[model samples]
Target: MPDPSTLTPVDRSGGVRMADVSQKSDSARTAVAFGRIHLGEEAFQRVRDHDINKGDVLTTAQIAGIMGAKETSKLIPLCHDVMINGVEVDFTFNEEKEAIDIRAFTKSFGVTGVEMEALTAVSVAALTIYDMCKSVTKDIRIGDVHLRAKTGGQSGNWKSEVSAEEPAQN
Candidate 1:
């Protein structure tokens, strides 16, 4: 007989499965994720001046990010359909790096953490920026997608080790 106790995210039958959180107590969970989209000079200028033909690029991306966060379970396999309590997408234009930094904060009171939701938000926001600005420049690049911080759950609190050497953007 296969030992069910040793199975994790997969059964002895070799089928992927979602983790059962039925026994876990509901708790307040939050996650913060970050990503960056590098835009060419022209595209960056257009985004900064709200000159993109696709409407307000940043605002549109922000909206898309929130929607994405709510739909994370639908997009990613094995993710639980969590009821997100809040989602916030913020952006920072780094002229020095010719990139726009995207940050997503997600909160939920559930059995599972909201890290996937936060990551999905940042990823979708970066993609939306690329889609909106592709007409101006094809040199767009998305990178540095990672979890910046997270709290709650059995893991407790965590934070990224990235240094705070960069100047704050308005």
Candidate 2:
């Protein structure tokens, strides 16, 4: 979520506004977000064994994720148009949870932070996975999407303090 304190230009009736990053100095910024798609037994096995007929699920999802990050500003109304420098989307199979763990890392050199990009990356990736595996079963669940960490901007650096809830990913 965008920091509430970073928002500005509240109206008299308490209407919220987007962050005005115009005056903020340009700096190297990065963010990481995570989410998962619970594909159940059959879908999970098919994805893990690379037997899905919709081509390589993970590879296609990764590409879609990067594209989604690039278009974050267009998709979200309050988001600023930041020039993203890099984006990485990765996935891992969780046998115990019958899920695919997704990780998205976004980098930028801009006045605004890229946490929204990172979040869009993971969400789009998870949605892509659901699309790919929906043929096997429509009983997929996407949840637990959250920002793991962010660096740069006025916030400096921040990370999720709930270490125990972090992904068991690389």
Query: 118 in model 2: Cα distance from truth in Å?
Result: 0.3
- Report lDDT (Cα) of residue 110, candidate 1: 90
Each model's lDDT comes to 0.91, 0.90
Candidate 2 versus truth, CA RMSD in Å, comes to 3.0
lDDT per residue (tens digit) for residues 86-157 in model 1: 999999998987889998999999999999999999999999999999999998999888898999998899
lDDT of 1 at 42: 91
User: Which regions of candidate 1 fall more than 4 Å away from where they truly are?
Assistant: 1-7, 163-170
TM-score of each: 0.92, 0.89
Root-mean-square deviation (CA) per prediction: 3.1, 3.0
Angstrom error of the Cα, residue 150, model 1: value is: 0.5
Candidate 1 minimal-lDDT segment of 10 residues: 161-170
Candidate 2 segments whose C-alpha is farther than 4 A from its true place: 1-9, 162-170
